[model samples]
Target chain A: MSADPQRGPLPAWSLPAGETDRIRIATQWPEEVTREWAWGGATGAGVRVCVLDSGVEADHPLVGGLAGAKVISLSPEGEVVVADDSEGDVVGHGTACAGIIRGLAPKVELWSVRVLGAGATGSGPVLMEGLRWAVDQGFDVVNMSLSTTKSQFAGVLHELADSAYFRRTLLVASAHNMPVESYPWRFSSVISVGSHEEEDPFTFYYNPEPPVEFFARGVNLDVAWRGGGRIRATGNSFATPHMAGICALVLSTHRELIPFQLKSVLYLTATNVGGDR
Target chain B: MSEPGRLQAAVAAGVVGSDEAYRALLQSIVEVARAIFGARASSIFLLDETTDELVFEAVAGEGADTLIGTRIPSSTGIAGWVLVTRQPLVLEDVTQDPRFARDVAERTGYVPQGLMSVPLLHEERALGVLNVLDRPQQARFTLEEMDLLGMFANQAAIALDLLQRARRARALVDHNASGDTAAVARLAETIETLEDERRAAGVRLVQALDDILRGA
Candidate 1:
């Protein structure tokens, strides 16, 4: 079970035993730029963002709206079934991601496209199919907070981004915060976002150059899970939405803007993270 | 010798007033048109605000005639329709469309089959029309083509507006002889903004346009 928010700042993810005293400073990323960078209602409300991860609970206050999710239920005779709302995040991890995206682009219509199973261990094909479907369905932005090792969908993803560019769409992927060799963050076609832990010691792990393009406040970040228990989250998964939100904001303001415009705006506005990479 | 954006800069810089500025501005426009489109014909028209008519102001085409004084009514022809609606007009068969007035055809003696006409609009106030005639018959105007014309037209409108303002300011500067301080200050402000925007956007435009050209 994750720590409760009522307990105030989970200790496990907190600075371990007073190591917070001499935490080395790095790039001067902004604090709470939801105002300066957001431009508020400039964009975000008009477009649809498909979050392909664990199923999101429809009833969650942060997770309101039908969003038209697809879920296949199975019968005893090895038959497929339909459970649209049931496809939502079964584990609390997916909920954490969904909330981050929701907080950022609140007005955006989100489709909780669930491709991962309970363990967050769905095969590569499942996620790729979701991405193709999202593009086909005319989503303006796609948020992928999941990744893999044996994924054959890398080339397909490049094609997907190019096609989205042709159709004027954006793909926002999380640069895995786990410090693992992963394809999700390393892909060039997608905007790779990493986490920057403000006042936390674990910040450097999130910095090195795998696919990290932009940085967002990520360490000990608060996210609500099932059963009213909340936990301070850690990982690049938590950071990706900030970049996605910024992209959605831009795409929304300048609808006629192509992908190049979208890319330029982000790079221009980004506060360069770390020093070396 | 000055390019379009740079000449606009010189005018803003007080090197010359509106008349000379517009004269050079229009020339550079047609020159760029000749360079990029490889078209033998190009022209610019100024809208008469009071009469709402298109009066041809400049021309650069093969055997391009002086329709300089001809005033085409806003409600009358193809170019007129383009000006009124602020929508681009393309004609693969010029004689086929009822909007094509045949006045330019009769005047220039060029029976052009393909034509592209873009509305010269400044903030929804249709200034006139920027037209290229005798375009190759097989050429179809794509969205990019339409937008490119619109972009060129946008720059032209800015230069033209500045040109007009500069001309009026020249008259004021001569007549008032430095007594009318307030109006002169406002004129200086407008000129500065235009020149500044052009100068700043020029640098960005070169980089971004190169990136776009290289297919990035």
Candidate 2:
């Protein structure tokens, strides 16, 4: 069916009814891979999740006690400086993401990699350094709620994303809220996410489109903010962490699942794909 | 004055032929944005790279009178965040958020309850920020609203870029001329009247000339 014209055309990375197709998976096992088998009852225990954004507030009630936190900054001499993050959540954006992940995967080890500074202002070099550090740490999942529009950093981001994928560190990145070109999220190696209006955190959809792989709840979320407060927020920024939390859940149960395998599990168990079954 | 010397004098003076048209364009953008979002106010802040500050360039509704030409550090508030991240942000309750930079808002004499800010970007470079503050309904900003705001910011960025280029061109022309800046004024007017594609091409040509003149 054609999309309703009144809705002002379908958004990018969304599939119309006519566009969605059913595909049969040829699995070695006779039983179909269901949501129950994938992540049900999985508390994301033993999974290491790195939130690569502004720092997270360790004391935020919704996001209790981070495993560790680090800040990426440039020294006066232009050298990359990685230091302990004593000051937390410069803009509350990272704390919001971390809180969502914590809510979904309570037992997961959450680490904060502060890339953005106060008021969420950050440079591309700091972001790249932060991502590189996260990749080196080999976190089970990395939630990147922010992206750099600078094309100059795309090459390095692409390499880092691929390295994460190969090393079994699933990178969950938020698609730009605007229809603009951005890095890492657009890379095939990452799980690119967009927003849906649904309130259920577990409800997610796998887009037939290539770039944006999934859609999750991101509208009007009451998320934890800095200073142990909560605020209403929206954007693809929040949706990405939901996917990361889910990834943590899957990895928690099936430690041997690689990045590509984890992605396949997500697609097969998406609300749209496996809910009815 | 010799040709080279005249050009040098104009460049040093930072002469921008009349800025009436530029101001009018930005004013129209903020007005339309304010109306579209049903917001209490809308404003545009252009980054002054030399001073590392954000200059209030246009406004509709609140702070339209005394806020224009006011400067704040480019890295101080939500506008700075948008500028650095080149991303759109929507905050529902600015009053409770520390990142709202209340001190800066207090200086402007209007602190919004909620705000949506987007980067005014020309290609990858962020030229400024477009902010829509405190819609009467206090409704949460939707993804669609953010997307529409981004489109508006793109248009604003192009106009701002052209205005900056016009200033440089006016400097070069005003310097060589013996107190007459009409040539550059006519060129700016002509460029503004061109079709979208041609206008962008024309702006590029002017920018190239400006770069070459500066290098000389």
Candidate 3:
């Protein structure tokens, strides 16, 4: 097959770069925002995080307990339907994401918002409804490891993302694995993440680029799967939850911080920014 | 319908009128992708939206002989997942994973240990999927390889989109042949035999006429 002239040699948002310029903090703050300071001793207690993808397998050993679980689907007439998720994790993707979050912030209140069904497939309308529900419920952090390439959903998703930001609900989205454009990851209001090959779960870097803001460990890690199983997988999908889990930890400690402030704290604590690279 | 008007409709739809050429293009895509990835097999499946099924359009390596035109539910396998989510995926140790849809793989007569699948996307619409199964050396696919596979899928998607348009045009032409548009069908067949440059000129002329007619 002929190469597409538009796409670069590497995947979107995976470009290597030198260290970024550090952000100068005001002298008024006595303590530096180290990783310990950002999430030190924080177990994500009382923080509500929503996994907005396929349903998370209930009682999965690695995932522990969930705060709530809901499934969003379409009716025969093409209307959105929201119901309790009795059937857990049609595919293992959501479970894998939830397990990652659970691993980092063990005490975070995890909620499963099942937007994708079997084979990890669902319509764009269903995805929007799921996100809207999560935002309306005021989850502290919503981990969206999936995105819609359909531009028709962009406007609505953008509005929802902005609304979440204003409501103090941080949306952590994964950049599309392919180089193609997608949302709501591309929106400035949301924190977009990509994968890094590093093994450290906490070793994340800040991208100097605009679209994908961060990269976390997503290559070849053992993740929780459906039927209470575990498997090895890799993608930007898994990286998103690591960021979300970190967000939960930060929110758990500093309850008053808004989305933007929380983002600044993350940048300050990033391995490239504060920790030893 | 007037000759220019009929030709304009065909041209407006971007019908190339060559099913053989489209199949050949897809065949080359699978072969090249298989070779590039050094995989045991590679194949492309076209989504039949009407039936909600995926039809194997082309294959290289294993199952190339009997796999063409095979139909499977578009809601079941890895290809189905890619089609619905419009995302690329990579999996290792497919046999051990319960979510791998082993029944579907068994039906196809080839069960892979590892696989990577990407949606063949035309704009936001997913035309189908391109799957590379079981690379020789490694069980896991790197992020870079997934990007390369996506590039191949893009080209395949464009060709598939054109092929679908051609099919629609053929059906339209056939439906109109019994009526006064018989001459238009004849002209379409004639245009198919023309050299590349002349055929392109004919297409451009038809498009211009279509624009004028639409304006009028």
Candidate 4:
């Protein structure tokens, strides 16, 4: 088949010079960012945190209630499945994530962009659309606990992830539990988290390796379920929300922190880094 | 039987008896490509000339059970891009590029972090796309891998063209040498049986590859 006569060759996918290693650390520790930095008067009051997953059960006591929630499912034909407000959680996954974020940053405005349902599986396009919707809504922090393994959609997801980053909307993604490669967690632009056995919910560690950059507590911990109850589950999925919660707290007080700056701040304040030793 | 040997067997069976054997041969090619790649999933789409769509004829990979009959617009997604451009692509980080279509991945269930795709061309005409999903971790796809996939796609395209021509030959035989209604009916039934075998074999190949790659 012949290529479109009008379309030219795409620009080479390259990074800016000196950005080959994106996550570099500052040699000297900032004295102002102490162990209590996350808890330093910022309750994430003005930041908006969007959970992109199965719809969250907003009425769950731990969640109190969502500031706003929307369902973004697509029909088998890729048509919009619903256009109005959300119907509620199909499973308890979103609720658990919401609970974690709410617990860490109590005053953050919570929103849900439901891209999955009872099957607990969603199409790549639907999830992409949900992420795009969250970004368009100008949410401060978008927590993506789920990811697509379809490589065909990678470029678009990367674009959206970068788009969110440039717009100052922090996208927090989880590394796959199966160890199989997936995205946008693999993208250096977004914050990627993995599960660690640390008991403290707020305790997170910066990885020395590339790809999976951070680890947070994702073991069996009590979290809100769909029926307003609690359940214990473990996966990198759970670890992601803890980081998102902390990010909301950080952004609330430091409104000027872009994704790069926020990540640096996180690296500096990590349990194993800087003065937290 | 060895993969190439199966193709020979299918071809022989198709030429001597009915058209079913040809389909088996085509499906085997798809399976062999999946195994060689150690892919999380793989699919073969045939281009629909009239509608400019790529219709899934065989899918072997994780969660691909329901994707056998799915159709994608020929102008959308990377498959379409590959078909139109007649170029092979190996994307280590698929999301970082702009050419990828997110909607197509959404339809497939899981978005692949890494992908390798090539167009199927025969006689300078684009036939469709052959794509493999995520590779084993720490193993990035290289130019050598892209060339290998392109080679596989070439062989598959030629084999498919042969299958179509064989089916046409059978129809001609029915019209001229074999006027027996019962024999013609039996030939049709045989072809149908062969299609089932082909589909089952393709799925089994993918499942086996998945088990092997996952170290299950």
Candidate 5:
């Protein structure tokens, strides 16, 4: 759920009656498909997925009933504390990804593992600590829509994800949106997801060698927000949710599929690169 | 299924060269034969035009070398029969058949009771034969079974022929790029090992025109 809130509430978002002063979040996903995925299968029901990102607007209408947070832990200095989100979701990137996951996997239980403190920056310790918490908490899927150039931090996330995969939890991380792939995404175990618009989903070949396992819609995407508002999103952060939601959808049907199997199925069922690639 | 599927996969993987693709292709072919038809053993032979003999490209089940470089006249043995007729040939018992040559049995340890061969022809030219040595659990190949085998042959032929042409083109380019006696020897040894996948693109031309060939 990596988005900048400035793009404004997503289109086609309607506020419910008597819900005055509520943030309005809209689906960038086409209504028909969203509605279909919602009604069709598990819709992420009963499955627990983790969203590790910036803080969520507790009062946001678009993410109503879904749960998330910054991992509360004792500081290295032995101080009891929670991640400082001086501006929780003030940018709306985390909110956008959360909305898409909900729209796609409405039935699944979700836990938000907030890591970014402000301006999409978080320490390696904070990010790794967040991942460990999500894994220990046993999430079916963990969507890390934010990553940094920190190689050591990236290694921690990848190793944890590799272990998590064996543990039946899928970990999806973002490739840096800066036009080239950097660490965390460069890590092997992580199912690195990249951003692509609906107009060019097939063209974004996740690096043939390393990182970039899959791609999803990210260009000009709308996400539901608080007070009946939504915002358009761009970049790999925005795209990771699509894969997370898809993981939820698949896990709902194939509860037995471990992370590797889940990754394999997605690669298999996805439009084959045979002729397309 | 995997041989063709994996070949298709490798082509898609853009993994040219290396024996790994060959191993993957062989495993795929065996799996396909067993799954699609209850075959006990199967082997794919490559025609070595320079030696005028068929060499084992892939083999599965018992007596694996039964199809490797087993040579005969162009119109003599069962393989030659396919080359001459450009059609599949079936033999219930090679001993009872008059067309069956006895001398070739010394090279290939296969004592045939039931044999089926589908000519791998692409663009109407014989590439090789796709053969199943024996049926599973005493079952024999039926006419209907052979037809399906024919269909498999048709797809394989087209894919293989395209594969070969691509190989030749690549060899020519490599030959010209590095000229020497050593280069020529290396080229011959490595061209088959250097497989460039042939892309299969669907027709976009149908949508280019307003007129429809078939009414909607």
Candidate 6:
């Protein structure tokens, strides 16, 4: 698995029988693996990160610009429809997440998939539909800053999360703002994030215990609001995009890395896990 | 008694001689917490709402007792972070983390490498923080352990709440009883002073009688 001749060609056949050849390549490039990512060099240049939240205003200055935007809404008769850029931000939550990602990774392709409505609440069916749309669109990283508390939709969300995982789309989900249970952030297939009070915008920590695997600077962060302005906000919702933006950076370089490999790289790059470099 | 029950008893027992039962209970909590988590030290703090300060109620560990009664602003230190945010934290390297204030540990003469702290919350309001410092063998805290400490923090919050209420109730009763005792002591002193005056009068009368009898 080593690219260097001294470490030699660690044979692909040496891996477990069912493992893919990419595993061998990943093993060869251990130097590329890290938990604490440096934001200075990595621009997340080509990676497509989809922000799934309360719609994004494509013209928001902090957002820079979006590569594409979609809005999922429930019709009067309860039909889920994924529409083009006809919709603007309902509550600015999605715009906030998009701005954070843009701050961290300046050149990444941004996609807005609006799931939450004006009240910052959305039905499970609409959430599922929007997530499905994002996954099917083949975005490299999907940032889900929202979650459904309803138990009825857990199975569907779980399935979609697994599908995204298998299809090499990294799902970064936010843990519930409160202590109460919510999904699909709880799903192991998704990277769960929580808020930390770190002052640095780019700094994040890897949680020793998970279900909430990461913590980013979500407390007192200035994020893009709806009216071409910024507002200081705090929540797990804001933290997910930080991870997603970081994921975009990781995926930009390690383009062939799958979900599992990406998670390993994140673990290795975490502030605590990788010796704080 | 259950833990809460015992904690209530310890507080209700009041001061034995010069030592405070509340202090004893707080120390017991720290000792039990340390033993349970295999931590090098443990400490309990109470939020003094009047002063907006976190008062170190009790401490158990090597030289940590010296930190008792230390007051920190409720918005300062790692303990303050837990109190303000109402979130538990487990840090693997206290020195490396910026949020971990070294000054608090310096004052206690114990610098912990790894620590876990949970807010002692009653209802939605945070009462204080319960800290387990320096996991001697482990580098970081596990979720199961953080959960366990959280549960323990809940119980401690309830216990501390009950103890404060009990103290207030006891203070009212003791205030009346002590007031009466002070009144009785004053009366006794007054009677003694009166008796001394009466004796002096008697002595004066005798002197007059003696002068009369002596035909001065």
The C-alpha RMSD of each candidate to the native structure, in angstroms, is 24.5, 12.2, 11.4, 17.4, 27.9, 19.9
Scoring the B chain of model 6 against the true B chain gives a TM-score of 0.68
How good is model 5 by TM-score? 0.43
Standalone chain B TM-score for every prediction: 0.66, 0.73, 0.80, 0.65, 0.62, 0.68
Please give me the DockQ of candidate 4 compared with the native complex: 0.02
- The best-first sequence of candidates by TM-score reads 3, 2, 4, 6, 5, 1
> Which structure among the candidates has the greatest lDDT?
2
**Docking model 4 quality class:** incorrect
The C-alpha stretches of model 2 lying farther than 4 A from their native spots are A1-30, A118-122, B1-18, B98-101, B138-140, B170-216
TM-score of each: 0.43, 0.81, 0.84, 0.53, 0.43, 0.52
Any residue pairs clashing in model 2, and if so which?
none
Among these predicted structures, which one has the highest DockQ?
Answer: 2
The TM-score, computed over Cα atoms with residue i paired to residue i, of candidate 3 is 0.84
**lDDT for each of the candidates?**
0.57, 0.82, 0.81, 0.71, 0.56, 0.71
Model 4, residue A24: what's the lDDT?
63
Worst 10 residues of 2 chain A by lDDT: A21-30
Q: Model 1: runs farther than 4 Å from truth?
A: A1-43, A72-83, A118-122, A177-181, A199-210, A273-277, B1-216
Listed per model in order, the count of residue pairs whose N, CA or C atoms clash below 3 Å is: 6, 0, 0, 15, 30, 8
Off by over 4 Å in 3: A1-31, A118-122, A177-179, B1-6, B9-15, B99-101, B137-140, B180-182, B194-216
Error of 1 at A183 (Å): 2.3
Report residue A180 deviation for candidate 6 (angstroms).
2.3
Q: What DockQ do the predictions score, one after another? A: 0.00, 0.23, 0.20, 0.02, 0.01, 0.01
Residue B195, model 6: lDDT of: 57
lDDT of 5 by residue, A78-148 (tens): 44355543344432445666787887777777666655431112234566777887888788888887554
* Per-residue lDDT value at A128 in model 3: 91
Which residue runs does candidate 6 get wrong by more than 4 Å? A1-27, A35-40, A118-122, B1-216
